[model samples]
Target: MTRVYTLVNQKGGVGKTTSAINLGAYLGVYGQRVLLVDLDPQANATSCLGIDKRSVRTGMYEVLIGAAPASPHILHNPRYKLSLLPSSPALAGAEVELIEVEHRETRLRDALAPVMDRYDYILIDCPPSLNILTVNGLVSALNGVLVPVQCEYLALEGLGQLTQTIQRVQKSLYRDLKLRGVILTMYDSRTRLSSDVVAEVRKYFPGQVFDSLIPRSVRLAEAPSYGQPISTYAPESHAAQAYDALAREVLVQDGIPTPAFETTR
Candidate 1:
């Protein structure tokens, strides 16, 4: 069975896209047949993978609106078993068109039905909002991981709205949807404020938090612009190693063995 995981957060520049790209890449490097679905219309994930958005003909937008099939849109990367269902800016229109459709939340669910058994994992990189497209992603997710809390001043504020959305989805729709865990990102270990934010998150999330903390690094911020995941672009960077560790933890939590930690970075 394919474990569908959504990397979602309402915050921007919190390393959400970075985590999605590298985690999916390394999971493929670890021998899992992974399919990365970029649900973000920004196409950052697609670009980070070296796939030009302009050349992408069929993507998540077409599939969700019943304009394309699931298989043809898959872009295979030469370096690994990972394939991608890239997204385009057109996906932003889904939020509005979905209003008049029956079972709008189920559109993505139905589109993914046939391909569920073909991969070991399906990673959905959601956009930075709790809109219909995200709802569609949430409806189809088995579990979700959030990249959050870059500081302490406004630690985990406005999270109630997101949790409420998830709770409501579980109550009346996808009862099986689960909050997999939270990974703290962009922590400047030199700051006491970073420490306070982690403490605050742990109080509410408890054992659900990942033990690995992602430090803010220039290498991470620059990797995407070069059209490469941190694992491939700056393999010796701390951010790369952090994501590799994260990939290992995700595997371990799923009852799969953790891969060897990379030390070069």
Candidate 2:
């Protein structure tokens, strides 16, 4: 059984793509068959994976348009057992076109069904919006939805909107959709507000929050520009180390035995 997760957040620049790329990479390194779908029109995940955006003639766009299949568009990552269904700018147009189709929200769900069982985990990198594309992702996933929340004062404010959307989806669509967990990103332990935000978020979300929090680091911001994950771009950076811990913790929670790694919990 494959567990599909979508890294989603209505707010941008909160390290959503960074978590998706690194988590997927580390999951792959940990021996899970992982597939990362770059659903963002910006194609940050594609570029961060060393994929030239311009050279991508077809990818998520075609998959959504029914012009090409996902499995065929997938490109394997050499450093990990993960694969990528890279996206391009063309995905922007698909959002509008998808509206005209029947069961538009289920298009991606239906497209991914035939190939879902092929991997242990499939992570969809949804764009920073609750649009049709995001709806497609939510409808397609099995049980997991990994939300990346920024560690800031107004962090929890926008979460309500996403939760409402999830509620609607559950009521009208995917009943099995699980709130896997929320990973705090750009956490600055130095900021007292960060501490307060965490405490407050935990107060509300409780068990829905992930144990691993991604710290803010310059390396994570630089990785996508250079087409590499933080682990490969700045292996010694704190962000890389944190994502490694995240991967370990995720696997541990799944009851998978890891060789030798201590998660921060």
Candidate 3:
């Protein structure tokens, strides 16, 4: 079965895009067919994986507005064994363009339907705000939502607002929409603040929180500059280990087996 999940947090710098890229990369490393949809207009996910967003003329924007087909817009990265539905700055205007379209909220779902069965996991990396684009992501999330919460003071507040948004989406948009899990990101074990934030988040989400916590690492931050996932940039690093573990947890949740495998360069 194909599992579709949207990584949403509304608040930026919470490792939402990083989680999407790294987690999806790890899933691919584990022998699963993975497709990462870069729904953010910023196109961080696209650039993070080494695709130049500046040159992407027709991508997710065209797919959403019915200007192009989803499959052809997909860019494959053999390095990570991942496929990306690249996004561009053009996607910034997609919301306004889609407003007049019928069933705007389901545009993503509709566009992704034909290719849904082509991959084992389709992870949508939503923008940092709750806009029409995010709404489309929420409605298209057939599996559920995966929120990456930063380990900081205001983490709870942001999560609460996102939960409310999820509730609203559940009631009005997609009833099957539910929180798949909360990923604790940017964790600094040396700081008491990070510890407290993790405890509080786990307390609130309880069983919905994943055990693998992503640490604040310099290497993780620099991976995107080189346009590679942490798994390929620093496979032996803590950040990679954490995301790999998180990917395993996600696979387990989906009743998939995680076999011991190594990436070939």
Candidate 4:
């Protein structure tokens, strides 16, 4: 069965998109068929994979509004061994356009239904807000939600609101909806604050936090500008290695076969 998970966080710059892009890359590297859905209007995930957002005439907006089928809009990146349903800036209008559409929250879930079984994993990179777009991503998360929290001063802020939203969805929308795990990103090993944030997050989520701690690395930050994942751009970097371990942990937790972590070309 395909594991459909959404990397969601209302707070911006929490390494949410970074996590989605690299995690999907590593999952693909490990021999799993992966499709990354760039649901964010900013299209960071699309550009991170070397795609030009402006050049994309039809993107997530078209698919969500029923203007086009998702498969035709998907961009296959052979280098990364992954497929991406690229998003463009036009997706920003979808929040308003989808307001009057029936079953608006489930549009993404319905849109992805046809291609669900084609891949082993489908990862949705949601926008950084609790609007219709994020709701759609949450609704389409068949497996669960993966939250990337930064290790900073305000790391725990707004999480309570997010938790409440999840609870509301669980009660009224998808009953099976649950938090898959919390990922701590941008960890500075040299900072005492980083250690404090990790302990605090763990205490808050208990065993629901992922064991992988994404270290802050210059290579990791520079990869997106070059339009590449950390695995390919800096495969030897600490950030890349952490994401590789994260991919394995996700596979193991989901009872999928774990593949040997090999160097990416």
RMSD of each: 2.1, 1.6, 2.5, 2.1
> How do all the candidates rank in terms of TM-score, highest first?
4, 3, 2, 1
| Steric overlap count per candidate | 1, 0, 0, 0
- Cα error of candidate 2 at position 69, Å: 1.1
lDDT of 4: 0.92
lDDT of 4 by residue, 1-265 (tens): 8999999999999998899999999999888889999999999999988899999999899999989989888888889988999999999999999998999989999999999888999999988899999989988999999999999998999999999888887887788998999999999999999999999999999999999999988998899999999999999989999999999899888888774634331
Note the Cα lDDT for every prediction shown. Answer: 0.80, 0.85, 0.92, 0.92
For model 2, the stretches where C-alpha displacement exceeds 4 angstroms are: 262-265
lDDT of 1: 0.80
1-265: candidate 2 lDDT, tens digit per residue: 6878888888887777889999987887788899898889999888888888878998998988888877778898777567898999888999999878888888787878888888888899988899999988888767678899899879887788999988899999899877888898899999999988888888989888887779988888888787788777887888888888898988878788888675433
What is the model-wide C-alpha lDDT for candidate 3? 0.92
Model 4 lDDT, residue 214, Cα: 96
What tens digits encode model 3's per-residue C-alpha lDDT throughout 66-141?
9998987788888789999999999999989988999998999999999988999999999999999999999999
Q: Give residue 18's error in model 2 in angstroms.
A: 0.6
Q: Which portions of model 1 show Cα errors greater than 4 Å?
A: 145-147, 259-265
Candidate 1 residue-wise lDDT, 1-265, digit = tens: 6888887777666667777788887788777889888888888889888788877778988988888888878888867557889988888887787798888888887988888888888988888888888888888887664545555567687678778888888998799887887878888889999999899898988898888788888898888788777778888888877877878888878887653643432
Clashing pairs in 1: 236-265
